[model samples]
Target: MSRALLARNGRRALPLIYGGRRGTDTLSGVHLAARRFIVDMSYSAHFMDFKGSSIASSMKKLVVTKLSPNFREAVSTQTVAVPTPGDADLLVRNRFVGINASDINYSAGRYDPSVKPPFDAGFEGIGEVVGLGLSASSRYTVGDTVAYFGSGAFAEYTVVPAKEAVPVPAVKPEFLTLLVSGATAYIALKRLGDLAKGETVLVTAAAGGTGQFAVQFAKQAGCHVIGTCSTNEKAGFLKSIGCDRPINYTAEDLAKTLKKEYPQGIDVVYESVGGSVLELAVNSLANKGRLIVIGFISGYQSASGIPPFKGGTLPVKLLQKSASIRGFFLPHFLGDYREAMSSMIQMFAKGQLVCEVDFGDLAEEGKFVGLDAVFRAVDYMYAGRNLGKVVVEVAPPSVSNSKL
Candidate 1:
C-alpha cells in the first residue's frame, strides 16, 4: 500500500480497494509492487449476503431509489454502485433500523428532501461497524454495535462520521428505541424546558415517541408528570410508564381536566402534538411555566388552515406570569449531543428508562416487501395503526432461518 493510502491512524484507506475497476487519483500518483494504484472517493455502501450476492437484487428485496410526495406511487428501487468511505467515515453493516414519524413525513414529502432522488430514507438506527476509513479508530471498531442519528439509515449499510456513532451498551435491541427517542426528549427537556426537580409537567401526545420519553424523563427529574393521550388504553399505558395522571383527551376537556387535576397549574408543558392540544396546553400553564414545543404531529397533514385559538390569546400572560414557550429540534443541539447521550445511556443502563416498539414482524410473517412497501407503512403510521415506535425489519444476510 502506498503511504498516501495510509491515514493518520495507520489503517490503509479501503476506498482505493472498494472503488470500481477504473479508479482516478489525480491527487497523487503512488507506485506499489510495480503497479499504479488509484484512489476513488465515494460515500455510500450496500448490504450483501455473506456469500457476496446483493440482498436487494431480487424484486422482493429491491432497494429504494427515489421518493416523491405520494407514498402510493412516488418510491422506486434500482441497483446502484456502493460508495467508498471518506477518511473520517466508518462503513456500518446495519442490523435493525428504528422508524420515527419524521421518516414517514419525509417519505410523504412533508419536508424538503435534502438529497435528490435515488437516495435512501431513515434517520436513526443501530448497526455494527464492519469497515473503517484510514482515520477511523478506537472510537468505533469492527464488530462493535452502535447507534446513530442521520440519513441513509433505511438501507442495509450506511457511512457516518466517527463522532456520530455511539457504542451500544450491553442491552437488548429493544433498548435502542429508547436511546434514539429518549435522547431527543432528554435534551429538549433539560435545555429548552429548564425542567427542575419536583416541578410539575404536562406532556401532550404523551403516548407517542417523544412523548413517552418526556413522561419518563420528567418523572426521573423528580417532577409530577401528567400525560395526555387519545384513548383510555393509551392513558393506561402512560400511567404504567410513571405518569402521575393520564388525561384522555377524547373523552374530557383537556383544560378542565388539567384544572381539576393540578389545580395549581403545571410547571412545564412538553408539547409534541400541536393544534387543539397546543392551545389547551397554553391555557393550562402555571405561573412562570415554560412550554417546550418539540413537534407538531397534529399538523403533519393539515389541508385546512390551523385552527384559531379559542377566544383571544395574548402574550400578556407571559408578562403577567413570567412564562415562556420554546421550540426545539434535536439536530440543532449537536454541540450538546454527547452530554445528552451519556445521560440517556446511564438511564438505560440502570433500567430507569424503557422503550416500546410496535414490531411489524415482517420478516417472521413473510409480510416483508421491497422498498415500495414503505408507503403502506407510512399510511399505517399516519392512521394511528401502530401503537408505538413502528419498525420494518430488514433481514441480515447471515441469518437464514427465514424468520427475521
Candidate 2:
C-alpha cells in the first residue's frame, strides 16, 4: 500500500519519495493531512466528536539551562510551539533521538556561548514527516520512515531540510539507532578515512557511539578492524559489533598491542576519543595512514582547562611517518549531501552496517525519567560505561511502539 493510504489510517509515518528537483504536489500535501489525522487520532474520543480543527500544538524539548563547566546545571527542558517547516524543510514527528558527547559539550559551553542558551540540543535522530511547506519536494510522503539532521530532535518535533533527511529501508526501529550512529561512521570511514578493502582500521573509543559504527563499517569495507575500549566487557561488545581485535585500553598498552597485532601498523584510525588514546593511535599509524579526528570526548569535561592535544605531538608524529590527520564534521559535508546520504542508505539496505544502542535500563518500561536522565547518560558515556550509542528516549509513549 502507498504511504498516503497508510497515512490516512493515522499510522506514524516517514518520507516516501527520493531525489528530484524540489517542488510541491498533491503527494506532498499528504503530509499536512497525515498530521491532522494523527492529531485527531491522539485526542480523546469525546474531542473526536467535535468537528473543529482545535489541535493541541505544543512540544517539549531538552534545553540547555546554563553554560557550566560541570555536567550538572548544563541541561534542562522547556515546552515550546512546534515549528513549521520552511519551503525546503519537513516537520518531523521525532521518535528516537541519539545522544552524543558533543551534545553534552555544547550544553557545557565548550563551543561559542554567543549562540545563547536555553536553546534545544540534539544532533540527529529518526522521525516521520508529518508536514511540509508548499514548495517542498515529492521525495517523501507523510508516512515514510526517515533519518534526519537537526538541532531539535531533543524535542517531540524537529524541522530538517528535505534534502537532509534520508528515506530509511524497511528495517526495525532499533536499527534507526544504527542510522544515527552508523551513518556517521560510514561517512567518516568512506569520506575522511578513505577506507580501502582489506586495509587495517583502528578505532579509539571503539565501544562508544561512533566507534561501534566505525568498527562495523570498516569490517564491511573488508578491513581488518581493531577497537580500543576501556574494559574487557566493552572489548567483548566491540567484538560482537565486528571488531576483529578489541584492545582493552585499561589492561594493555595500545601501541604495544597494535604493534603486536599488526606490525605493519594501521591504514586508518578513527579518532573519536582524544587524550592518551589519541597519542597512542598516532604512533601506531602506518606510512600514508589517515587519522580522522571525529571527536574529542575524552577532554569534554576536563576541569583543568587543557587543550585537547599538546600541539607538538601531532605534528611530530605527522612529520616522522609522513602521515596525515583530517578533521570531519558531518554538517560541512552538506555540499555533497545527496551522494553521502545515498551511500549510507544503500549500505543500510544491504545489511552491511550494524548499530548498537544503550537504551538505558529505565527505558525497559514505557516510563522515562527526565532530562536529568539525559545528563546521567552523557556522564555514563564519558565515564566509558555505555556499550554503544547512548540514546535518551524523549516522550517515551511516542516511541514505545517503535521497532528495533
Candidate 3:
C-alpha cells in the first residue's frame, strides 16, 4: 500500500517509502528495501489504471529522448521516474492527451526560445488528480477530472499548479468539442473575427481539428461558411456540418472558384494553412473584411519556420479593401474563456455540438492507443485523413468498488 513520489520541476527523486515500511534514509538501503518488499506483491495493484494507480517513483511518458533536433523527428517514448509535486503542484494521472501542431513544432526546437533538448513533450490533456503537495489548493480532490493546457502533457503523469486545471463537464472531455479545438474555434471567430450574421466566411484546411469547429460555429452564427479541403470525402464531411459550400481543392482551382463563384469576396477569412493558401485568402477578402491568423501550419515543418506568401502588393490589396488581418494565439485568450467554455460544454452535453471520434487505423492496425500511436496520429492529421479532433488515449480512469 506504500507509494513513492518525489519531484522537482518534473524530475523524479527518491521515494519516501521503499519496502513496505519507512525508507532506511540511504541510497543502498532504498534499493534493498524495494527488492525485499516487491517479492510477493506485484506492482500491478498500483498502475492498472490512471485513477486507480497509486503514486509510484517512476513512470512512462513521451520525451524528447533524441531529436533530429526538429519536429519531423520530434519525440520518442521513454520510461522515467515520476517526480514529486512541488508544494503548490497537483499530480495528475493522464487519461486523454491532445496533439497540436505546436507539439510538432516544439519537437523541432521551436516554441519557447529557452527550452533545451531532452525536455518533456505535450501541451494539453485531461486526467484525474491523484496526488497533491501540502501547499496545493484544496479546491480539487484526488480523482476529480481536470483538463489543462500546459507542459508535460504527453506523460502518464503530470504536475500542474491548481489554478491551471479546468474542471470538465461531468461528460467525457473530448478535446475536439472542448478546450483545444472547440474553444479555439469559438474564441477565434467570436472574439477576433467579430463575425456578423449572413457574412461570407471562408475557412482554409476546413476539415481539420480546429477548422471543423470554425466552420460549424460560423454557420451557427448565420454566416455563409465556405470550407476548403483536399478531398471529395472531406468536402462531403464539411457539407454535413452545415458549410454552405465545400470546395474540394484537389478537384477545383481555389482561386478560379473564388473569382467565378463569389465575386463579392469573403467577409471573414479564417486562415491556418499559410504560404500559398494565405496569399489566396488575402486576395479574396471583401471590403472591411477581417482575416484571423491562427497558425501557419503550412510552414510548421519547414526549416525556415516561416510560411512563404505571395511577394507583391500583399499590403496594398488589404489597404484597398479596407481589410485587416489579426493573429490569434489561444494561450493569450485562455484566462477569459471560462464562460465561453462552459457554454460550449453545455452545447456538447445537450447534443448541440457534434461529438465524433476517429476509429480509422492508418499506421496502426485498427485504432490508435497509448503514446506510441501519437506519432501516427500526427502523421494522419498532416495527411488530412482525420475528420475531427485527434485525441490520444493515454490511460483510462479506474473505478473502484469501495463505497463512499
Candidate 4:
C-alpha cells in the first residue's frame, strides 16, 4: 500500500500483523515494529502533504511604503495574512521572482500616479500552485508549476488569476524570463518592428534582460544585429548571442563608430537606453527604418524619472529619413501574451534559445536570498552588473528526501 494510505489506516493495519503462530497474545514484538512503521509512514505523509499545501497563517511580502526614486528606500517587507484565493485565483508559493529595470520606475510612481503608497511591489513570479480556488481547480491543481504576471510577486505567496498564469514544464527560472522579458522582445519586434531578413538592427542595452532576447530574435529573423553595452564582458555576451557587431559604447565612441561602420544607416533600432544613446539610434536610422522604444533605463534612476531629451528635433530627424519611432509597454500587449509566451517556452525547451538567469548567487559582494535580498538584486540590475535575467530567490524547494 502507498505510504499515504498506510498512514491513514495505521490503526486498522496494526492488528493485522501476526505475532506468534495465529492467536498469540504476546504481541509486543509485532506491535513495536508496526508502531515504528506507522510513525515513519505518517511522517512521510505529512511531508508530502505540506509540499502541496501550507499551514502557515501569514507570509511576508514587500510593500512600497512610499514613493521614492531610490528603490532601496521605497520598499519594506511586511508580514501579512496569507491571502486566500478567490473563486478564479490560484495561490502560488513563489520560488523565484524576476527583476526588471522598471522596478525603480514603479517605486517612484511613474507608472500610475493614482496608486497610493503601501502597494504591492513586483511584476512577475514563477512558483508552484499550493492552493486552488473553487473554479481555479478546473484548470490547475496543487503542485502544478506556473509562471504568472501580476502585482505582489515579491511575496512568498501570491494569488494570481487563473487566466493570467501560464503552466510550464517545471518551476525553473528560465520560464520566468518568458513572462516579461522574452514576451516584450518577441511581441514588439514581430508586431511593431516588422523585422525583415537582411535588415540591419541596433539594440541598445543589448545584454540586458529583454535586450538579450531582442538580439537573438533579431538574428533568428535573419537580420544583421548590432548590440551596444557598457563593458567588454557584456559585449562578449552579445557576440555569443549572435550579435554581428558587439559595440562596447564606453570603450569606443558610439556615434563615430556607427557613422564610420554603417554610413548607409541602420534599418531597425530596438532602443532602450535613453539620452545620448537614443539620439545616436535616431541619427543612424535608414530611410523607412523603425525604432522601437522599449524603455529608458538611463533615466530611470534620475530624480525626474526619465529626463526629457534636449534639442527637441525628433520630428525633424524622423522626417529627414521617413523613419518612425514606436513605444512598447508589455501591459498594452496582453492580448498576445499566451501565444508569445508559449512560443518562447517551446523554443527554450528545444534549446533554440538561451535563457540566462542571474540569481545574484555568484556576486562577490553577497548572494540574493529571501525578500531581503530583493534590494540588492535591484541594485545589481541598475548597476549593469547582471549578465541576463536577474531573479531573486524567494523560497527554495524542500531539500529533505529521507525515506522510511
TM-score of model 3 vs. true structure: 0.82
Q: Write the per-residue lDDT of candidate 4 for residues 1-404, one digit (tens) a residue.
A: 33322221234323212122222112111111111221221221211123324436789999999899899889998999887677678778888999988888899998999999989999999888766554565555556677898888999999899877887767889989878899999999999999999999999888888999999999999999999888998888889889999999889988999999999999999988888788878889999999999998889889987756764888898899999999999999988877787678778867899988888876766778888889889988888888889999888774423110
lDDT of each: 0.63, 0.65, 0.72, 0.80
Error of 4 at 50 (Å): 4.4
lDDT of 3 by residue, 364-392 (tens): 55566777777777777776677777777
Better of 1 and 2 by lDDT: 2
lDDT: the better of candidates 3 and 4:
4
Could you tell me the lDDT of residue 116 within candidate 2? 78
Query: Which candidate, 2 or 3, has the higher lDDT?
Result: 3
TM-score of each: 0.76, 0.76, 0.82, 0.86
Taking every candidate in turn, the Cα RMSD to the unseen true structure, in Å, is: 9.2, 7.5, 10.0, 10.9
- lDDT leader: 4
Model 1 TM-score on a 0 to 1 scale:
0.76
Task: Choose the strongest candidate by TM-score.
Answer: 4
Please provide, for model 2 over 1-404, each residue's C-alpha lDDT reduced to its tens digit, 9 standing for 90 to 100. 22222231244434332333332222111122222222222211111100121213687777877876465676666778876666567767666677777776777666665777777777777756666543443454454456766676777678888766766643244555654466567677777888889899988888887788788878878899988888888888887778899988689877777888799888899987777777777888998999998877767777542336665767777888889989887766656455555555555556666656686663434223443466666666666777777876654433223221
Candidate 4: pairs in clash: none
